[model samples]
Target chain A: MTGGYMGRILFVNLSTGEIREEVLEENICRDFIGGYGIGARIIYDRQAAGVDPLGPDNTLGLITGPLTGTPATTGTRYQAVGKSPLTGGWGDANSGGFFGPYLKFAGYDAVFFNGIAEKPVYLFVDNGKAELRDASHIWGKDTYETEDTLKAELGRGVEIACIGPASEKLSLISGIITRRGAAAARSGLGAVMGSKKLKAVAVRGNQKVPVADKERADRLRSEQIAEMRTPVAGGQSFIERFHKYGTSSGAHRSALSGDTPVKNWGGIGVVDFPEPDSLGGDNAIANLAGRAGCWRCPIACEGRLKEGTGEYRYPAGTRRVEYETQASFGTMCLNNNIESVNMANHICNSYGLDTISAGCTIAFAIECYENGLITRADTDGIEMTWGNHQAIVAMTEKLAKREGFGDVLADGVKVAAGKIGRGAEQYAVHIGGQELGMHDPKLISPRRPSQPSAARYQADATPGRHTQGFGPSGFRGHFLNAAGLCMMGQMAADPTKYLVGFMSAVTGWECTMDELLKAGERIANMRHVFNLREGINPIEWQVHPRITGNPPQEEGPLAGVTADIKAQVYWNLGALDWDMITAKPSRRKLLELGLDDIARELWP
Target chain B: MTSRGSCGLKPDSHRLNTSWYEGSRRGQEWKYCPMFRCVVGVFGLPREVTELREVEIELEDGARLRDIIAALRREIPALEGDIICAGEDRLTDNYAFNINGRFYQDENELQVRPGDRVALLLLASGG
Candidate 1:
């Protein structure tokens, strides 16, 4: 097992079908020098802090870094992580094909998983043998017919990853799906892999990684791929208008920079399209079937869209759809039909959903069906209209077959606005159940000194409207998913000119992006002590009180944009979101947030 | 068959063609139709006839789309970029040219003739 950067660490439990192995532990790969810092130090060291992300005492954590599965341009993604059941926070998610460098050349860098499995199984590795068998006919399939019936019953060099039946019926806006519509989506972690009754994995290894000094890490990876393939500092006319209209060629540049998020937020025009750049510019050149990349990625923003089938039927395969499910289900739920957002990203990757909280809770049930608060007898008779792309692909298959009222919208938008109340939680454009991630931070208006809500939701925690330290107060400090960089090269570098030269080059460890932003402030205060040991303190956060102390969205160009959340609580916002300005903090935000062992497990 | 930039057998990018990134990365070098790039740079094949469907390369009859953009600006001096008119008048046209179909996306919207089935595109920006 020579793979220099790591050797193994596979685990797997499927409730005792047992298969273990650990080895690769050089002080956990020299202080987390891997993508997402060694999966947040293996879930903050075997998570105790009230686990239950989808119970079976949660654990998924998948990982793979040292530029996992190599050729590290976009460092072969990987991630997966756990503790999320939609916004219990601290759930990680990452993806890219070539199944994370074929699980780090079959000699894993991580894998974990745990309990709950008496039936419907499936694990099957190749190089370093693994089993877990019998998936009672691919457990209610649909992650694109279980990756085409397991490469047609395990034939042509396999590589899989699965979850559907809304993560085997654990849907809090589930996710996982690989290949047929790529997605390790976010947060809901496919209801933490259907609370662990796990059903699909399939790796294939081959080895040959070892290269601590393979000619000086291939000459610092060919000088960071010749400074990320030249043409910069002048915005390659915004990266060739983003690889010629991919990233839903910015749904008409985010509704012409009013930063699109209509319907549910209650307004913003264009009912039935013609221009949002002519239906998001010919839906980015008709599902552009040209590029693809993941393992050893080179910003090959993996787009490969073949017309699904005549009469323009896109979403068959060669998946990739990013840019927040192309602006959370294209044009923030107004649907400028890119073949109905490629058939709502193939019914959320064939039913393993999470198209940004299923397109922000289907634009909050079409604003509670245009405010009669759910009619057509709570929508079973469909007519939740507003640019109906065939009733948003028959309500994402009745919100992933939870059927009628899509079982209160697969229970998202804060338990479907606490089981459909008429105030309709003042327009459920979600917060706590992870939705706002597609940049509608009310259109980037920040100057920061304190960060007073940087625009809004000042502090209604929901891991969704994230970015607490408000993007390291405009660049020089940068935090947007640290260690997992690229908010498009943090909109072109400066997180203090590359966080101390990207931590003294990966991890020969020499800190200073203010001490590697104290490990992203001890991984965001150990995910707020794992969501205050699952009690979710600070008065159990949740938002959309028409967005705390309102101002933004009253009508586009961020009508009246507000929230300067007390300039990040009188400038001491420190270690970003430090449980929002002291119920008790300071010790220089915990020794500049080395976060004394997560403040001694969140104050003992 | 017309192996240019992604090794031209082009049967729908013929099953993930990775003969290690197709022969020294696009050398059968570049250029096309400037008198068939000096006959495919001394004969490698830009034409033994390379049509894989979608024909209609203008000039076959009563021409005039500016006389086939002046005979493809005298056979591809990068035809000064732009052209489209591919199937379905590319939804309400300026003859759909912000390129990105097969090449020429700088704007100068390439005009065509000789019977015009012109599919190749570019002029692209945001969707």
Candidate 2:
């Protein structure tokens, strides 16, 4: 491989303590690119159908893209892929930090783990050398402590991705934590790591990722940087704002515009929480101590909050809680305290819980409590009340520890509701067992019944994720993720134009826009196939009524808006070349992407 | 251009000055006598506008935020009708504007002057 990849895949069988290195085929690299694409293809080929997601039969992949370790802006990201315990289908999550770059530097494009270990252990990769070390002392520690301890034992420069108590407890909402706050926080992949008895992956590398053409790579990089600095149509620069306020800058406005789902997707913004500015980016910036960015990224959107003197004081190194976390903990819980939200963020990060799922689960509990379905008797003597920051904080701790009612909620809303009975399931706002992200479908009108609506992506094989394939931009996002570039970097310039240049220069392959989009679509459909093989009927997956405007609000920004989910799904099936009735990819479409084997197996 | 009004006031009551006559020719220079000035905070302009983050310009007696935007478009040229509409009726959905701390989707009729802060907010992707 000329430009982007290290051309090596490390396969480790934890059950037998065997490690093997396999060369990544050039054809596969050219067709799939890297990141999610490589991970999805490997999982589909190696893992058997219907393997228990938390069992040893499931394979866990940690992979980076060709551009990961290069000087490319926002290129430091890695993708984690495995069968999701939450959705029972294809699951993958990506995060930005130093891990991806370091992983590539350690002389491998991807690492796959199979079988369960006899005891807790962590994978240590130093340059080209690899081994599994005993992690008994750090097994029960939180992610922050585990990272610190591992770094102390193996130099400060070594980057680590580790699980916390939530994962160890087998919570379906658990995620792998990296660089303090950066998280592959969706799909419960952390539970897979726990099942394998793998606590962390530590890497330190000194090798440079070979660039195909130095002159062309430098030219493309400089041009892209200059273009990123240029202002766009609306007197605003994506790079500038992202650097200043990160994503939190839009929290207040999004709340006003009905983007942030208020009160567990059951309430409207204006009617439920009128004064949302208190939790906006400006206020978050007011408490900022400094900025923390991923490797080689100029736009340092990660904020470090100042340590407070009182009860809600966050530690100095605490990353600023993002809009999604803020909305989930603040407006979704009816709590307007930004500091409390920050505290909740810290809890989720340290304990390795997905904030969206955790907040939504807690909200479901409150709704159940309000409806008298459950009382303090069900809540371990803690009063689950709306706007009760203290109770919210206490419940989060319990969820991480899997104690009392927290244990019930740890499995996520759908399962928790099923356990409680008494019509409590009606309060659970989720799709296929995964909690929905903060975005409300009703707020933004769907252009087509099946025009890549938010509801459709939420109901996809990897259910309840906001970042799954949605539209052209969504497809581009997938491609960028494959190339190991952050989505934020995509906002600065059109990926179809600029990213292609970077890819061609780095990989020495004349990549076309159509090829890139096709690769992205192939990766998505392959994941869908993973679900279909596992007995998931995509069309049968339900979208929550609250999100579809089943009971329309009397007043608000999205008063009469309802997402036509049936039409939306049908539209999506047609657009993606999937069988409308069965929700499987058409055999013809699979063949087009060079997945003849998949087509034959699926259709036959 | 002839100076209209000039008076140094207390710090608390300080205001900008404008001396442009009605129907003044385009590109005509005006004197600042004593009036109000509006400060447009370009906190998050799109990448096309370069590195500009803040701009201060003298305000007409009945100038609205739209007029200030128009004056800015004239000054930057690259900003013409890209940020604010040519009619100053509405802003593109990609950008949000705040007048004295109040966010507005349509502020064509909203008045402004010097000392008042107009903040431009960017609502792109990422976070």
Candidate 3:
């Protein structure tokens, strides 16, 4: 058996109240690795085609990778996998906090939840014992309140992954929040959890995750830490900057250089939001009450904001706003009020909402209102104007509660556009149903014909995600996520110096770079195959003309820069050996990746 | 020393290239004396760390990308050993060199024409 896994999986059916414990096979662990790798494989085999994502038939897996709770630096992530209620295809979201490690310690490698409970319930896993407890009292509470309530009842040591009011209302843009505000906040999996009438999964355990070669693992960890401590080509180490500023440090530069989308991808950054320095590193850390790290991560990037004292007041200790949140609320809506943006972050965290979708939705609303497509009456008397910080925060809280106009936007821009019809689709900037990440694709250099960053947005299995599908680098990223390693961890250290070495030590596998690459490719293919079986055609996915710069912008840093998305997508497809039109991986390629069964299933 | 130098700019004239002067030297009044100047945009690094967001660098007539980088290292003490390694023109995988909208991953042979826009930017990866 592999050293990292708990060798156990819990399959709980809420509808029938059937609780079954199954042995996690070593072959499955070795073949797929862990996290979404194992999740994608299992869901593809077990779930039927076209199963309603919010229905009982759709299974949800909360999975952690082998390195999750181990001595590996930033081994602090877990994946939430199911058919996405948002994209309606292959879906997965990962979060970093204490929950993933605690779940492993609670004596399970993964937990698969199915069916709707007769009443609201929460799963309690203590040591090696697991059971369902009534959760009626905490169902309506926000995530922060729910955490406090559960901890008071369960114990202070328990780590929880739970939904808030937004999820309970089944907002499609909702997600699961843990440990105050760390969110697995994409794919609308929170709606899936809510649909199952499950509120939370609280875990506490003391078991240590076994490492095959503890000596080697410890040595590699020390070496990696030392490398991180050593300054980069620049005097300051990457970890030093990350620990100090987090992603907020990148916000100003991203905006100025055209990497960050401004005015909902329709306006330019430098021209629209000239003074972005206020939102950058120095200001980002101005209100930092403390630093937050996941598990044993040395690069404690996440920060706790000091209490709000201005107009938009929020409680102290709210999770600091990340770059994505900053862009989505700051430049995207043209609202530069730091306090309001911070308050918006607070609202989203408390309600368990995806800030990307929520912020983008508000920007969409602002555009719609400006065009006279909607009015103050529709917004419940709040003027949905660009840079109206008060209105933005008001609308965000309304969206969290799913009230009035908020109900129209709670699902995201894609769904809101559908409801508002009269040419509102033209203003909706989304790929499929998910809002594009804060990064802009038009910023890609024209010299690089096959730039992976630009194309990954459209070609990745989960369309519109910035983090997935980077040809070869993406393969490693998939494996990293599966291994429960934080991307920040990989970024801080020289991964070539320690990534494969650390994995080999922890899993007791003679995992060479070649072998790890193949595993990553296999994992990527498995995820793509899941989408193919669901009848999603990658060729037909439409990227907004504004995003592609169809009729190039007249000003700003990215002026006249139109992304050749179709060519890039085709290039990506050819590289992956997938049929361009059908978007299915070739049988030969699948077989080469050791996906013999998947190859047969597709080729058959 | 001629008031109108080789590049045809006055020694103490208000040529006012704020990008360079404001960032590197915040308050000191200095004369622009170089025969050739290229505007360099610094991206992906924080203002506090780099001290200069953008700066116009003085280089020799046949300056290449490496020379501009070397000049930047010498002028900006914060960036001396950070973006590019000391005494090495090659950039690690973490950084990229973008000149006139074209990106060079590790290419050191690219010629830097006078008045070219050279940007020292971090490669987009990671969160």
Best by DockQ: 3
For all predictions, the C-alpha RMSD in Å is: 25.0, 9.1, 6.1
User: In model 3, how large is the Cα lDDT of residue A5?
Assistant: 87
Summarize candidate 2's per-residue lDDT along A189-307 as a digit string, tens digits.
Answer: 99999999999999988888988876887777777777777776455666677777887876555665556777888876666776777887688778888887889887777888888
**Candidate 3 deviant stretches above 4 angstroms:** A445-451, B1-126
lDDT of 3 at B15: 44
Runs of candidate 2 exceeding 4 Å displacement: A231-236, A445-451, A470-473, B1-84, B88-127
Better of 2 and 3 by DockQ: 3
Order the candidate numbers by TM-score, best to worst. 3, 2, 1
Which has the greatest TM-score? Answer: 3
lDDT of 3 at B107: 62
lDDT on C-alpha atoms for all candidate structures? 0.56, 0.77, 0.82
- Tens-place lDDT per residue, model 1, A333-388, is 67666667666776787888878778778878877787788888788888877777
lDDT for each residue of candidate 3 in B48-70, tens digit (9 for 90 to 100): 35655566655545667776666
TM-score of each candidate's B chain against the true B chain: 0.17, 0.61, 0.63
Give lDDT tens digits, candidate 2, residues B68-107.
5556555555554655566544565656555543455555
